[model samples]
Target chain A: MTLVTVDDVRGAATRIASDVIRTPLLPCARLSDELGLRVLIKPESLQNTGSFKVRGALNTLLTWKENGTLPEGVVGFSAGNHAAAVAFAGQRLGVKAIIAMPHDAVESKVINVRRYGGEIVPTDDLLGTTEELASRYGYPPLLPFNLPEVIAGQGTVGLEIAEDAPEAAAVIVPVGGGGLISGIGAAVTALAPSMRVIGVEPEISNALSLAMTHGEVRELPRAERTIADGLAAPRAGNHTLENALAYVDEMAVVSENAIGEAWADLADSAKLIVEPAAAVGLAALRTGAVSLPAGCTVVLVVSGGNADLVKLAQARMG
Target chain B: MTLVTVDDVRGAATRIASDVIRTPLLPCARLSDELGLRVLIKPESLQNTGSFKVRGALNTLLTWKENGTLPEGVVGFSAGNHAAAVAFAGQRLGVKAIIAMPHDAVESKVINVRRYGGEIVPTDDLLGTTEELASRYGYPPLLPFNLPEVIAGQGTVGLEIAEDAPEAAAVIVPVGGGGLISGIGAAVTALAPSMRVIGVEPEISNALSLAMTHGEVRELPRAERTIADGLAAPRAGNHTLENALAYVDEMAVVSENAIGEAWADLADSAKLIVEPAAAVGLAALRTGAVSLPAGCTVVLVVSGGNADLVKLAQARMG
Candidate 1:
C-alpha cells in the first residue's frame, strides 16, 4: 500500500504554495489563560474559500493540469467547503466544474460555489448525483477526501503546524471524512514524532472514533443530526482509516451543545467566527473531553469559517 | 508643526515587529467584482488584541521602556480597542494599567481589557475619570488617539498597505478621533504619493469629516447613535486635524444603516467577522458615498473586530 509520505506533503506544499494561504498560527491568549496551556490556533478559516479544503482541491487540479489530463469539466460532491474549493480551483485553472452539494447545505456555501463559476447541482443524494454527472459528461471526479493526492495536499497543513509550533505537545484537528487528520497525522508523525495528533468529531458523527476503537473502518447506522454539519460524514474512508491507525494518537467526541458553545467562545474570546465543524477541536478542549498536561502547548486547527450568518446569529443569541 | 513621517512609521514597524501582528492584506473578491475594481482589505481586525490599536500602544510602551521613563502604571480612556491595546501593551511591558471605559462600552471589550491584566474603571465620563485617576496615582496617561507616538505607530499600517498593494489607487480608512487616518494619510502620501488617502466617518459622528470641511478642528454638537460604536468619538483631536489637513485628500460619511449592512456583508462574503466601525470604509464604498475610477485598485483598512457578539448576532439576524 503506497501511503502519503512527508515528502509527498512537501511536494504538495510547493505545488499549492501560490494557490493557498499560509494562514497565521495565532496565540489564543484568553484560551491559554483559561487552559493553563499555551494555546495556538491555526486559522485555516481565513484561507481562501474559508477552509483548508482549498489546499487539497488546488493541488489536485494543478496536478491534473500539469499532467495534461485535465478534463473539460470536473465533478465533485461536498456538504459545502470542498465544493467551494473545487469551484475556486476550477475557476483559477480555467477548468469547468460541476459541484453537487447537499440540498440542505448552507446558503452562503452554495452561493460561494456558484460565485466561483462552478455550476451547482443541489441534490438529496450528493454522491449519487456527482457520480451520475461525472459518468454522463465523462468529467473527472474530484474526490473530497479519499484520494492520496488530496490527503497529501492536506498534509501541508501539518508541515506548517510542525514548523510554526515546533514545541507543540499536542495538535487537535477536527475530523470529517478523516482526510484532514489522516494527512496531518502522517506529516506530524514523520516531522514531529513526539507530538500527539488528536482528532475530534461531533458525538453524533463519531465515525473516525468508532473506527479506531474497532480497529477497522466502521459506518454509522444512519446519518445523525449534528450541529457540526461538516463532520457529519457517515464513515471514514479506507485510506484514512489505515493512516489513522498508524499515525493518529487518539480520538475525542464532543456534544452538539459543546460544539455550539465552543463556536460562540471562539467568536467572543478569539474574535474568530467559525462554523460548528471548525470549533469541534476547541469544543473537545472546552468540555474537558480532551486534556493535556499543564504548561504543554496545544495547537487547534480551526478548519473553516463558512457558516450561515443567520445560524451563527441564532447560535450567539442562544 | 512636526508630524509623523514615513521614517517614523518605518521605525515603529521595526520596534513593534516582535510585538504586533503583521496582518495580512487580503483581496475582497466579491466586492472587487461588484465594483469592477480591485478591492483589497487590510485586516487589522486580525491583529493582536483584535485591532490595529495594538500597533500604536505597543510602539508607545516600547518607546517609554527604552527611554527609561516607563511609568510604574499607565492610564487610558477608550470606548474599547485602544483600552485593550493599552492593557495588552502594559501587561507585556510589565507596567500596571488602569483603563477607564465608557459604562456602556461593549462587554467583550471591557472583558478583554481586564483579561490583559488592566484594571477596568467603568465610568459615565471616561475622559474625566481617566485623567483624575492618572493624576491621583502619577500614572502616565496613554491618550487613545492624540499622541504623536501613537499616530506614528498606527502609520505602520500605511507602510504595509503601500508595500502590499503598491498599485492601490485609493485607500479608505475609518476615522474616529482621527489618529489612524492622520498616520495613514501621512505615510501613504510619503510612500505612494499618487494614492488618494480617504477618511470615512459615520454620519452621526462625522468629527473628522466636519473638521476637514471647516479646514480646522471641529466638534460634533453631540455624539449621535450609530451601530459603529468604535467611531462614536465626539470630536477630532488638534494633532489629528493638523495631519489630516496636510495629507488627507477627501472625507466621506456613511449612514448607520449602511454600516450595519456592510458589517453583515463582510461576514457573509469575506467570512470576516468585524465590528461596524471596521466596516465603515466598506460601507462608504457600498453606499456609493465614496467612488473610485473604474478598474482602479482600492484598499480598505478594516480597523478592528472587538464587537459585542450579541449585537453582531442580532445584526446578522436582521
Candidate 2:
C-alpha cells in the first residue's frame, strides 16, 4: 500500500507555509518539573483556525490548485475542527466548502465555519450526507482523515516535532481518525527514528487502538459521543490505519475524568486554553495511561484550543 | 539617582536563570493581519507561579542569599501576584514568607500563596500591615517593586525581550508599581535603544503615568480600583519613579471596557489565558490608545495568567 511519504509532507509544508502558522513548541516547565520529564507542547490551538486541521485542509486544497485540478467546491464531514479548517482553507483558495455537520455540533465550531463562509448541511448521517452533497454537486470530497493528501499535510506537524524536539524520547499525539498520528508517525519514524510515536484516544472513542489490534477498521456507534468532539471519529480511514500500523509505536486510551482534569490543569499551570481533544495527550501521561520513564523527554501535540470558556470556568471552579 | 543598570539586569539573569521561565515570543498572526502591524507576545504569564513577579521575588531572595545576608523570614504586601511569587520563592530558599494581602484579594491568588507555604495576614492597609508585621517580627521587608534588587530581577524580562525580538518597534508593558516597565525600560533603553518602551496602565489605576507627568510620586486613593487588580499600585516607590523618568519613552492608559474586551479577545484569538492586567497592553493597541505605523513590529508583555477561571467563564458568557 502506498502511504504518505515524508517528501509529501515536505512538499505540503512548502505549499501551506504561507497559509498556516509555524506554531512554536512551548515547554511545559511546571508539568516537566512535577513529572521529572521534559514536556514540550506544540500548541496548534494558537494556529490560524485554532487547530492543526488547517494544515491538512489547506494542503489538500492548495495541492489541487497547484496540480490544476482545483474543484469549484469541497464537501466534508467533521464534528468540528476539520469542518472549520476546510471552510477557512477553501475560502482562502476561493473554493467553496460545504460541511455536513452533526445536529449537536459545538456552537463555536458552527460559528467558526460560518465565519469562514462555509455552508453547513445539518445531517444525522455525516459521511453519507457529505458524499451525497459531493456527488450531487460534482464537488470533491474533502476527507477529514484517511486520504493520502490529508495525511501528508498532517505529517507536517511530525516534521516540526522532529525538527523542534529531536531529543524527544516519544511524541504523544491525540488520535481521532488517525490522520494526524499517521502522518506524524511516517515523518518521525523516518526523520527522528529514535523517537517513538504514541497515539492516544478517549477511552470510549478507541477506534484507532481497536483498528490496530484487529488489523482492520472498527467502527463505533454514532450515539457514543465524547466530550472531545473533535476526536469523535468512529473509525480510521484505510490510508490512515495503514500508516498507523506501519509507523505508530504504541497506543493509549485516557478516561473522561482524566481528560477533564488535565484540560483544567493545562490552563491553570501552563496558561494554555486548549479544547478537550487537545488535552487528551497530556491526560494520557498524567493518569499513567501512557507512562514514560522518568527523565525522558516527551513532545505532546496540543491539537487545538477551540474550548468553551464557560466550561473552562466551571472546570476551574470544580 | 542610581537606577536598575543593564549590568544589574545581566547579573539578575545569571542569578535567577533556573528560577524563572525563559518565556518565548509568540508572533500574533491574527492581530498582526487585522491591524497591519506585526505583534509579538512575551508571555511571562507562563512563568513559575504564573507571573513575572517571580523574577523579582526570586531575585530579591537569591541576591540576599548569595551575599550571605540571607534572613530567616521575608514579609511583603500585594493585591495578589507578588504575594504568591514571594511565597513560592521564599519556600524554595527555606525562608518563611509572610504576605499581608487585602481582604478582597482574588481567591485563587490567596489559595496559590498558601499552597506555596506562605502565611497570609489579612489586612485593610496592605503596605502598613506588611511593614508592621516586618518590624514587629524583626524580619527584612521584601518589597514587591522599586528596590534595586527587585528592579534588576524584573529587568531580566526586558533583556530577554530585547534579545528575542531586537527589531521590535516598541515593547508595551503593564505598569503597576513601575518595577516591571522601569526595569524593562532601563534594559531596552541601554540595549535596544532604537526600540520604544511604552508603559500601559488602567485609566483608573494610572499611577505610573501620573508619576511620570507630575515629576514625583502621587498616591491615589486605595478605594479606586480597576479590574486589572495586578496593576492597582496606588503609587510608585522612589526607585521605580526615578528609573521610569530616566528610561521610559512613552505611556498609555486603557479604559476598563477595553481591558475586559481585550482580556476575552486574547483568550479567543490567541488562546492565551491571561489576566486583565496582562490584557491592557493589547487593550491599548486594540482601542487605538497606542497606535503604531503599519507593518512595524511591536512586542506586548503578557505579564501574568493567574486569572480567575470562573470570572473568565462569566466574561465569555457576557
Candidate 3:
C-alpha cells in the first residue's frame, strides 16, 4: 500500500482552497494558561458543512472528476456531517448526489442536505444496518471511510497544521471511522517526524483504540451512545486502521458528560458553537486523558458544528 | 466632529489585523433567489465577542491607548456580548475590566464575561438605570454609542463590506443604541455613497426609528418585550440619533415574532447559531418592512451571536 504523502496533501490543499474555508488557528489563552502549554485550535467547526468532512469529500470527488473516474452520480450513506459534506461536495463540483440517511437522523441535517440539492433516501429502521440501504440505492455507494482518496484528502488538515505550527509537539483529532485521524496522522508523521499524533474518541465508541490494541480492525458489538454522534463509530475501517496503527502516537476516550461539558466550556469561553465530537479532544485534555509536556504546543482539531439543536437545548437545560 | 473618513476606516482594518477575524462575506443564494435580488451576509455573529461590538469596543480602546488617553482600567455596562467584548478588549490590552450587568442578564452571558477574565457585578434591579453601578466601580464606562471612536471603529465592518462587495446596492444593519448603524452608515455612505444604508430594529424597542420621527432621544415608559435583548435599548444616545438622522438611508422595525423566526430560519438553513438581533435585519426583509431595490445586491450585517440558551430553547420548542 502506498501511504499518502505530504505532496498529495499539499495538492489537496490547493485543490480545495477556493471552496473550503481555511479555518483559523486560534490561540486558546485560557486553555494554554491552564495546561501550562501553548494551545492552538483548528476551527474546522467553521467549515462549509460545519465539519472537516467537507475537505475529504470535496477532495475525493474533485480528484475523481479530474482523473475521469467519477460516475454519472455519487451515492453515500451517513447519518450526519458526511452526508451533508457529500451533498455540498456534489453541488459545488456539479455532480449529482444520492444520500442514504438513517430514519432518525436529525431533521436539521436532513434538511441541510436537501437544501444543498442532494437526493435523500431514508431507511425505515436504523438497527446498525447500512449495507441494505446502500444496496437499495441501485447505482454506486460512496463510503466515507474505506476510500483511498478520502484518506489522502483528509491528510491535508494535518499538512496544514504542520506548516502553520511546525513547532507543535502534538496534534489531537477526534476519531470516527478513523478517516480523519488516519489522514492527519499520516501528514504529521511524514512532515514533522517529531510531532506526535493523538486520536480522541468517545468512551462509548472506542473502536479504533480497541483495534489498535488488538492489532486489527475490530467491531464493537454495541454502538456507544454519545452526544458527539459524529465520533461514535462502531467499527474501524481497514485502511484507516492500518494508517492509525502505523502513525498515531496515542489514543484517548472521553465520556458523554465530559464531551457535553467541553462543548459548554468552549461556547462559554471561546464564544464558539462546536458539536460534541469537535470538543472531544479538549474534553480528553480537560479530563487528563493526555498530559502535555511543559511548554509543548498542541493543536486540537475542532471537527465540525452541524449540531442537533434539540440535543444542544437539552444539554443546556440540564 | 470630523466624520470618519475612508482612510481612518482603512487604518482600523490594519490596526485590528492580527486581533480580529476577517469573517467571510457569505453569499445567500436561496435568500437571494427568494427575494429576486442578490443577498450577501457579513456574519459578524461569528466575531470574537459573538458580535461586531468587539470591533468598535476594541478599536475605541486601542485608538485611545494609541492617542495616549486610555486610563489604567476600563469598565462597561452590557447585557452580555459587550461585557464580554470589554473583557476581551481589556485582556488583550492588559487592563482590568469590571462589567455592570442587570441581575436578570442571561446566565450564559454573565458566565462568558467572567470566563474571559473580567469581573462582573450584578445589579440589584433589572431596571434601566446603570449610572450608579458605573460610578460605584470607579470605572469610566465604555459606551456602545455616544462615543465617536466607537462609532468609527464599528464603521470598519461597513468598510469591509464596501471593499469586499463594491457592487452591493444596499447594506442592512440592526440598530440598538445605533453605534453599529452609526459606524456602518458612515463607512458605507463614504465608501459606497450609491449604496443605500438601511437600519433595522425590533418594533418593541425601536428607539432609533421613533427618535428619528420625534427628532430626539426619548425614553419609553415601558421596555417592549422581545427575544432580541441585545437590541432592546431603552433610549437612543444623542450621538447615535444624530448619526442615524444624517447617515441612515432608511429605518424599519420588525416584530418580536419576526426576530425569532429569522433566528430559526438561519439556523435551519445556514446551520448557524445567530442571536436575535443579528436576525432582525433578515426579519425586516422577510416581514416586508424593508424592500430591496430592483436587481440590487444587498448586504446584511449579522451583528452578534449572544443568544440566551433559554430563549433559544423556548423558540425551538414552540
Candidate 4:
C-alpha cells in the first residue's frame, strides 16, 4: 500500500503552489473571546474552484502529465465541488473531462462544472455510470479521495496549518469520504505530533466514525440524508481508513440543527458564508462534542463554501 | 488645504500593515469568462472588522498616537461597519470608544460593534447626538469619512489595487460618503494615470453623482430608503467632492433590483456574501450601467460584508 508521507505533502505544496491559492488563516476574534480558546480559521472555501478539491484534482492531473501517461480524457463522479475541480483542472491541463453526477445534484454545481468545460453525464447511479464511461471511453478514472496522489495533495492543508499555527493544541477537520481528515491527520501527526487531530461528520453520515469503531473500512447499512451533502459519503475509502487509524486522535459527530446554528454563527460573527459541510468542525466545537484544554489555540479547517443560496439563507435563519 | 498625497497613503499602509489584513485580489473566473473582461475582486469584506473601514480607523488612531494628541476617549457616529472599526481600533489602541448609532440599525452590526468593546449610545440623530456627547465629555470625535487623515487612510486601497493590477483599464468602487472612491482616485491616478476610476451608488442615494454634475458638494432633497443601508449617507463630504472632481472619471447609479441580483450572483458564483452597498459596483457592471471596453482588466473593490441574514436570503431569492 502506498501511504501519503510528510514529504509527499511538501512536494505537492511545491507542485501546486502556482495553481492553487494559499488561502488565508484568519483569527476569529469574537469566537476566541467567547470560547476562551484562540480560534484560527483556514478558509479553503476561498480556494480556486471554491474548495480544497482543486488541490487534489490539480495534483493528480499534474502527476499524470509529468509521467507522460496523461490520458486523452478523465472521468469522475461527484455531487459538486470535486466535479468542478476535476473539470477546471482538466481544462487548464489541456485534457478533456466527462463528469458523472446525480440528476438531483445542486443546480449551481452543475453549472460550475459546465462552466469549466466539463461534459456532464447525469445518472441515477453516479459511481456505476462513471466507471462504465471510463471503461467505454478508455479514460482514466479520478476517484475523489481514494487515491494516493489525491490524499497527499489534500494533506497540504495540514502542512499549512502546522506552519501557520504551530502552537495550536487541537485541529478540527470536517470529514467527507474521509479524504480530508486522513490527509490532515497524516500531515499534522508528522509535523506536530503532540497536537490533537479530530474529525467531524454529520450524525446521519458517520462513515469515518463507524469505520474507526469497526477497525476497517465498511459501508453503512443505509445511505442517510444530510444537509451537508458533501459529507454524505456512504463508505470510507480503504486508503483513507489506513491513514486515519495511524494518525487521527479522535472523531466526533454533530446534528443537522447544530450544523445550521454553527453556519449562522460563522455568517454573522466571522462574516463568512461557508457550506453546511464546512461548518461541521465549528458545529463539533460549538456543541461541545469535541473538547480541548481551556485557552488552547485551536484551528478549524473550513473545507468548502458551496451551497444553494436558499439553503444558506435557511441555515442562517436557524 | 492639506490634500491627500501618494506619500500619505504609503505612510498609512506602513502604519497599519501589522494590524490590518492585506486582503486578496482574487480573479473572478466565471465573471471574466462571461463578461469577456478580466475581472479582479478585492474582497475588503474579509478585512479586519469585516470592512475597509478599519484601514482608515486605524490610520486615524495611529496618527493621533504619533502626534501625542491621542485622547483617552473617542466618539464617533456610524450606522454599521465604521462603528465596529472604531470600536476595534479603540480597544487595540487602549482608548475608550463611544459610538452613537440609530436605534434602527442592523442587529448584527450593533452586536459586532459591542463585540469590539465599543459602548453603543442609541440615538435618533446619529451625527447630532455623537457631536453633543463628544463636546459634553470633552472627547475627540473621529469623523467617519470627511477628514484629510481619513481620506488618506482610505487611499491605501487604491495603492493595493494599482500594485496588484497595474494593467487594469478601469476600477469600480462603491460610493457611500465618497471617502473610499476619493482615496482610490488619488492613489490610482498617482500610480496608474491611464486607469479610469468610476464610482457607483444606489439610484436613490446618488449624492456623489449629483455633486459631480453640479461641480460641488450637495445634499439630497430628502433621505431615500434603500436596501443598501451603508450608502444612505445624506450628502457627499466636501473634501471627497474635491478629490472626485480631480481624479474620478465618471459616476454611475444602480437600482435596488440590480443591487439584489448582483448580491445573488456574488453569493452563488463568487461565494461571497457581501452587503448591498458592496454589491453596487457589481450591480453597475451586471446591468451595464457603467460600461467598460471589452477585454480590459477591471477591478471591483468589494467594500463590506455586513447584512441581515433574512435580507440576504431574500436578495438571493430575487
**Per-residue C-alpha lDDT of model 4 across residues B5-110, encoded as one tens digit per residue:** 8888899999998888787687776677778898888888888778899889999999999999999999999888889999999999999999999889988789
Instruction: Give the higher-TM-score candidate: 2 or 3.
Output: 2
In model 2, pairs of residues that clash are none
Model 1 lDDT tens row, A1-318:
677889989989999998787877878667887889988889888788888999999889888878888878899999889999999999998888898988889887887788788899989887789889999999989998888889988999999999888889999999988999988988999989989999999988988878878988887878556888888887888888888888899899998899998887787667777888999988898788899999899999999988876677668767
lDDT of 2 by residue, A231-317 (tens): 989888789889998999999999888888888888887788889998898898888888898999999899998888888877766
- Kindly give the stretch of ten consecutive residues in candidate 1 chain A with the minimal lDDT sum: A308-317
Q: What are the candidates' individual DockQ scores?
A: 0.44, 0.69, 0.26, 0.51
Which 10 successive residues of model 4 chain B have the least lDDT summed? B264-273
Model 1: residues >4 Å from true position, as ranges? Answer: A94-96, A192-195, B14-18, B93-96, B117-123, B131-140, B162-167, B192-195, B293-297
lDDT of each: 0.86, 0.89, 0.79, 0.86
Q: Model 3, range B163-263, lDDT digits (tens) per residue?
A: 88988989999898898888888888888899999999888888888888999889866864567878877788888888888899999998888888888
| Per-residue lDDT of candidate 1, residues B118-185 (tens digit) | 89898988878988999999998998888888998999999999988878999999999999998898
Error of 4 at A109 (Å): 2.6
B1-318 per-residue lDDT for model 2 (tens digits): 787799999999999998777888888766787778888989888788889999998999999998999999999999889999999899889999999999999988998898789999999898789889989998999998979989999999999999988899999999999999988988999999999999999999988778888989999766668999999998988899999999998899999989998898877778898888999998999888998888999998999888888887777666
